[model samples]
Target: MSTSTSADPRERILILGAAGRDFHDFNVLYRDEPRCEVVAFTATQIPDIDGRTYPPALAGPLYPHGIPIVDESGLESLIARERVDTVVLAYSDLAHTQVMHLASRVVAAGADFVVPGAHRTTLRSRRPVIAVTAVRTGVGKSQTTRHVATLVQSMGLRVVAVRHPMPYGDLAAQACQRFETPEDLVRHDCTIEEREEYEPHIDAGVVVYAGVDYGAILREAEAEADVVLWDGGNNDLPFYVPDLHIVLADPLRPGDEAAYHPGEANVRMADLVIIAKCDSATAEDIAAVEASVQALNPGAEVLRCDSPVTLDDPAAVTGRRVVVVEDGPTLTHGSMSFGAGVVGARDAGASAIVDPTPFAVGALADTYERYPNARGILPAMGYGQGQTRDLEATIRAMVDAGVVDAVVSGTPIDLTRVLTVDVPLVRARYSLREQAPGRLQAALRRALGR
Candidate 1:
């Protein structure tokens, strides 16, 4: 979309977001532009992210009185009351039809519906960048990112990982977050989902940066790196331009590569498309995904890989009925019924997977109703302390009533850190492994000009 010009009167703006993209757009494109005044930010898609101000410290000198972050439902009224002249849709993972519906609503409210393109929003880095994005959430983006980082390290280059924004707390403090140690997570008050992504990268001795302002985050990361790896979130595009744009496709959901919102864009833009979890998919499914990618982007290179699943404690899961606790976004908005945990439990000889619905309490129960596709697996939905406590209580109640013998968690971080479980809790872990022998190495060599 065309940015507001100097000739245009100073436009009052309302940003539509889910916390991540909203802040990035403002910081990179609108913060100091002088041609636009962002009246408010509207949040959705993640819980407990609304009702806070986008603190003035990060809002820059232009907005001395910070920007209000209101709930998305009040978009129309806010537009009318605040006299918002523009509404920028700055979030991702939305279908095209859904995007248009919002656009229609914005137009009806007499405001220009703006979606800043990649050029206006994506940052350019000093170091060579490699971005790992996916066709959708839960399609092995994390493992693929780790694989790229590991590859970069193997080449003896310092690589800093800059994750897509998940700034759900104090905007000022989170303007540029750095996570180098487990304690840093506590220092930043990272949510469970944030910990999942950050802790693993920290374990690898890689500094991970995120927060409201990506330009600031990038500068911090670039100072100590030979390469910057953009570990993307959801199915969102990268916040920086890359030397190598590696996108992932899931064979389990074959046609999604060409069908989903920005996923189709990723497939078309990718330098390489790695069809992940091929070993787990049927031959037909694998072929179907490859065919779709080939048709969508005829020149893109395709690699085969698998997110091989394993359990941290397989013995505890053997010969028992278990409850599967999956990644929150995966089972919820990601729309995956089972995650690595379920696969691990099944492989470890679990007799059955207990459906947690009957025993779920509070927000835990609400999750089941919300995602009917939850498929008996419990989603680990702890955006805040209340939700975290509810997760613990649900698991405790289930174990007490003997709903299952063990709990298999497919969540990335160790759940025991937050929940006290009476019975054995098995953790599921998965990592990216190339199916094609030297494809990844060759690609990396080309990317780094080795």
Candidate 2:
């Protein structure tokens, strides 16, 4: 094996067998590395080889940026002329033999051979960050975050949950302690100590910091946690970049007209598109939604779920709702919602919280317009004097509207009116309720049947 001094910073690294996603990976790895400068790309000839350009220039027209494409025929001459010292072979198993041959030839020309081991180096340096966002609020953005976080945590890995456009609060405080303001969470690497003085909150062996920007929180969590889950988006196109992204669809909301447009951009960036509220959707509606998602994200996986599945046994549901609270606003809200769901189920003799929004009844009725069982309910939104009254009103409206079987909110509202008006209220900060792991896991088990 020919060897060169590892300390040499000027070594010309020639990337071989680059194609498709592998090529993209190579570009990301050395795009800004101080020591590595990718000078050229080379590929081997196969049967009926298309004369298309290699390393397909990222920018410009035709050849683009003047990055020369070399085949096996021009390998030796190009290597010699470029004074290439190191070769980085980025090829799959099928091209391994061809890459080895090229390495041998390069080494014979008085250069060093660097075989990138088969042990997936990309996964190590390239953390797959996924941003969960919604077109608008109250569309289950926070609920989706909790569900995804639970899935990630169940995979035997650590996860950090962050709720953006909000501030971090105390998970232990009974009255919900607001520690740092939203602005403080936006700063890069803002020391944890500067904001709040509290004990650490760990979930499935992973430490979680609630209420931070999706990007900033992910960066911090990526340093320590295996995966990070963002609860909300602060602004449009929250980040210029992301590995994968998801957008939740809420059919019950009337103002969702603006959602589909932003979804166009989000779909372009997403590796998968998930359609929520599937239970209330018709076959034609599901098909339409799928087509919409596919138009933006071609070849992206689309998963649909009507509502989170409830644990079969009451004990499981009770355990998930009544115990094990996670840190963060999203989680806290999720927990409260789940607890309310459990309460609703118990009171109504129902299995789960069905249609937890006042508008859900109208939406469901419209969806099942032809069905005889279809019904509509106009819920009352009560703005009470105290927090408890507000919470009660929200829960009562939801329950009476047939949106929620049980109510969960910070304040209390009169449910007596719900019986007459067909609406029930569940009062709780939804952002905090969705953070609880038990709630998430229960919801996932209910939704995905896993």
Candidate 3:
């Protein structure tokens, strides 16, 4: 068979094994391609291939028009008759070999064969790194660090949450022990007390020790974790260059001088700046911050977050939950790591918190006005990393905004450590399995009444 006529713009494309998630992705890719048109779908007549019904097949009577399903015997004739120019293999892993064989045949038959780009793999022993810093203290950086850790763990990757050096607090030390894996330390039996012997910060009520050797903690954590979330203290720069720098700022801090100043050194390093305490800031205040941040870092993206937003809340999340994961120069600088407690809560069928501000609940109210039934909200607070005054203000803001919710966190500090803060705390060790996408999705679906 041969084509008697031809069109200049539309190229006939043959899609093979178009009956699964791979096909769905292809559909999305080709939906708006003006130069390529998928004309047919071909597959073998085996039980594995033929027995399964096409799940959510592409919509018909659309741009691609009707997709003719063809078998192996009919493939050559169909291609000739339809004047197909290219063949695309859309089979999943189990059927990859079959698709390859079919593509070989298509190429031999005088048609171009297109395979998707090879999956890029990084051979580095180190994992990706992401630095989590705040423009100042009390912007819920600790909480957000935990959340990112959970997210990474969900991706089937190990993670370590690192904090800047500080005066060691027993609670912080104990929290570190809880997150430390047996292999992270020289010996599994090494107690926090023994671990802190070489470092005096343990008794200072600030620094905690998670298992891995302190000298190589960052490197080891980077290698073990798919992503490492480094919690940088005020005016501290993480040792490694970050692929992405996240700066959390609390807009409600009392003095304007304490707020994020565009001229400040820290703000200049941020790839993304999130203004916390959105509920406490007036419109004028928000605008001022935005203008200042833009002036300081023209390339950086700024986001505003309020606390206590829920799935049922109609006034939350006007924007899509835009998340980007990448691997770069140093594994530690590229990805964000989430904590184990957050993962456990999501896996245990609890709603995930997504706040990063004191007035997160109020910001959520505004978000609901734009997007009703947002899946989750990022709340900001509960981890110890701010001045007493700032912490009190954050707690008060949450209360004023009616943001009451339990939170999960992990620290190198002692497990016995407890905070008498206003909100409930559910502390646990960190792990990778609890934050899986399916688990999180299911939890959100249940929360949003899906």
Candidate 4:
């Protein structure tokens, strides 16, 4: 490994990310710093994200040719080749041990490893911000955020939600996106994962903003809002400094609150700890999660909520052999075995839950190999056009073999909108129902003041 220092006075940096947080961190901290030159970004988690450039338009004037995104497996080589002075980790949903392992590798390769301080990177918002995050992915953050938005609107305040970045395609075009109608999603050519998060907000008549440059996104969102709602992604903390920080912990994954990297940090900083899915989780599990929360943040107000799962067309799945498709991020990186589709199927007395493994194709097959935790059911892993096609093919293969009679889709958005499957696609929905109804509103009043 070459260790010779660069002749230039500026420090060379390499950002390790899964596509979302890395760009935001660079834009916020180093874009115009003049002392740091970002040599490259290493990509992981999402597929087909590598081998692309950050695009000069969004990279600012310093990087005229733009920065290259290489595969994460080449981290050590890139560090040596670029003589990187610092390596910054800007991803989410990783265990503490996993983070340490990466740190050790960076140090061994003769580069400094840095996890940027959460507070240092967070931008101050002019509008009163209410941030809804989770101890891990699939902890019902979307439902909780929507509920908070409704509460703010009920007080006669105009509210706008800003989602965490998921700019998988065209960084320049996705610098700052606003979604007010279904047509906006089409105009942007949104993937299933993008639609899953943005469509629900649009359906509820709330305007949503997302994309690469959060500083630009925030300015636009703040202008139209009495309150800014930060809808966090993948167990990550909010990008904006929040007046009310509400963190959701899942009872199903009881001890996970203390196990993950930034997730545990979120627990410690939360103003309110919401134990979601009380109806689905057993009493013992619920108590275990609550005990962990109390141990972490004794001052935080804890509340229980039910995640009631229901099927839009129960008859489509009631007596049929069905293939259940759940939210991708929840199953793959979120590390959950099943989602609402499985629960709704069993509740509706489906004949049998067909295993989709045998019918997996291309990217879908690769996903199963990577995340062995996702079993029996299929994860809706559509990050790009090819992955979406693979998902469609895998489902059709199951139907062609006559293994399943219908499809149970538990994704937040309607799957029929994107895929044209041969079988009847039943939509399974889950929503947040607070156990102590008035408590959340009461807390909101205390934080925001009616």
Candidate 5:
């Protein structure tokens, strides 16, 4: 059975994840456990995150030789080569069937497939927590999180947001990070994704913390915050046991509330369910999602909200054929045809949304192949120098092709800061405002005991 005999033969565990939840699983679930040893981390989703080490600084003293981070492609061979006894699937946003496919492979490779429950990895925080999560990746979780932070601030509570970890760099240095200023982002060597999430919070005048060691990050956040905001990632549940749990469901993806992993768990556990994108979706779609939420979780309060896109420069968009660039994750894994960029562009009277497919290059080209949902918009994909360059080149090609007059970026951060597109690039921004306002405000008031 390959059961552990003693200290000499501990269970060699390999964790499968993209980067975020995988590291959190190890930190909270098995970092110092004497019965198991985390042999390696298999990364997917985020690019170039593999071929690195889960550095000894974060790996702890027992594992002086930092655990290796490898691509999930070699899962079977790595399982055999590392003598892995158990494989914990720690990432999020996969279909149940897809999750089971990997589980089948793990079982075939002669290792136990473990999916730790939401409660298993959740840490207890010293302060009160308000967690914002979603039923899917692009269900406007980030916007909802921003709204919660704003409400908390409105109440005059000193709130610090603990974003789900995006520690794609040096784990040791990123063990407990705080991003209060633009310099903090540069200091941490923040990637485009990290900046997209953190910069908005900083702009909102709320401090944000994220990194490898969430326990340490929580403590650091708790020291200053009257309440800690758990800004969740990729349909995963709150990393902390929350005093208030707000879950967002996308009307665009009606049945997904009960379909995906951990996300459905989030749906069941939520104190409040937000049927977001009410403005963009049809009545039937909204009712279907609301019905699903009600059927699955009748006790939870459901609020309807609209995510309206606003263009920074409406004049720049009107009467122009624009190359629209939406957030990368939303377009890729989130499987959306368009985001705020396309919506804002159309609303602003844009002549047409230029097709970036013809100009796609490198990972951007591969991204189109991987997820064909992006029909008229480009994904603002910039995981590294190569991807950023590819995005710039694609946008430039669209301009050079004379199909687009300007660029409209729907990412949270300014694309110009990271990439150089030859044409004028305007940003598309969106925020959550409840259709029935008292529902959200009242819920927050009760949660915070105001």
Candidate 6:
């Protein structure tokens, strides 16, 4: 909880991460600070990212050799071995109680635990920033960000979306990446998760910037923009301070606005609160979320946004048993039973929804074991090449068994882009449609002063 600076010479530090915020904090706070030394980073939440180095190119001049990234399971041993002075938690979407449990472990290990100050870690942007965040993952933050970018562009302002870090691949090579076209995604070797976030923005003709170093990423985005839009990841705060902070809440999962970590912080700091999926949730659930938001941050302007799921071709899955593949993080960490794929499948008149549990292979099998809520629907868990193969194999096993006739993909990116599926892959596309249209435009005008 403390962000105080200590002048202790060579204060050895270890960062607890899931490969995203941990890298950003180091880049902004410790990369250039001469008094502190980042001994190592511990990884969790994300798979296969540990056992790698942060790479010297992005570690700055302070570290001639890059820092080691280890498994968080070895926290105590590493802390004692390195004589660590501080341990920083840099990931998001954790329960407040779980955060404290990690803190307790660090304290018991004779190391100080710190959560970096949002202000200290956030970089200042030369251009005005409008951030779109959520209280949890899969609360329609992606569609909301697209809507914000499109609105800003309608005003003849060049807006570049700066996404939160998901640097699961090569750390040094992804130091500062700019994606202007679809080719950029392939050029950078983006994973399905990264593509799911980036491709939609690119399709909208909005340039997206994401990498390990947010300060450098901000500088690059600001050079060609009049406004910067922060597309936050996993309910984390923006890397750049925003002039207008828009936080989203999911009516489908009411009370999540107050339940998760940093999500509560986002609601407390919001300039506007948008309750997403109003059409899908019951009126009672919607009212509950609205009431919670009012109690938490009464000053924030409240609005409703309807997220409608539509399939590219309904006939493909009509009257057939099909396997549904939903967004990875949404089902696993977001703790959702189903997603747009399920809705779209039922809407398309699918006879039955095939549970991909028995057919799951490799990492896909491990995912089902870890998150039982994801039993019926397959989560698109492609963090690396091996996982991607597992996803493809899982789907193939389902199709080969002659149990399912089609595949319903609810992920933002096209499944055909990454995987080769033999059966007809029906795409489920969802977007934000404001209930009170001109109200959001009016708010945007006020925020930009245009």
Segments in model 1 whose C-alpha atoms lie over 4 Å from true places = 1-8
Better candidate number, 2 or 4, judged by TM-score: 4
TM-score of 5: 0.96
lDDT of 3 by residue, 61-96 (tens): 334233445565677777777888988754332223
C-alpha lDDT score of every prediction, in listed order: 0.87, 0.40, 0.43, 0.92, 0.88, 0.91
Task: Report the lDDT tens digits of candidate 4 across residue range 319-359.
Answer: 89999999999999899999999999999999999999999
Off by over 4 Å in 2: 1-126, 168-207, 211-219, 233-240, 251-261, 309-450
lDDT of 2 by residue, 366-440 (tens): 222432222221112221123224334434455444434333222112233222323223322222222123543
Point out the higher-scoring one by lDDT: 4 or 6: 4
The TM-scores, one per candidate, come to: 0.96, 0.38, 0.35, 0.98, 0.96, 0.97
| Candidate 3 off by > 4 Å | 1-125, 167-178, 181-214, 254-263, 309-450
For model 5, the local distance difference test gives: 0.88
Candidate 1 lDDT over 167-281, as tens digits, reads 8777788888889998999999888888888888998889999987888888999999999999999888889998999999999988888777678888888999999998789
What's the distance in Å from true for residue 114, model 2?
Answer: 47
Locate the minimum summed-lDDT window of 10 residues in model 5: 1-10
Better of 3 and 4 by lDDT: 4
The lDDT leader among the candidates is: 4
Q: What is the lDDT of residue 202 in candidate 5?
A: 94
TM-score of 3: 0.35
RMSD of 3: 25.2
Model 5: CA > 4 A from native: 1-7
RMSD of each: 2.9, 20.0, 25.2, 1.7, 2.2, 2.9
On the 0 to 100 scale, the lDDT of residue 307 in model 2 is 48
Q: Comparing candidate 2 with candidate 6, which one achieves the higher lDDT?
A: 6
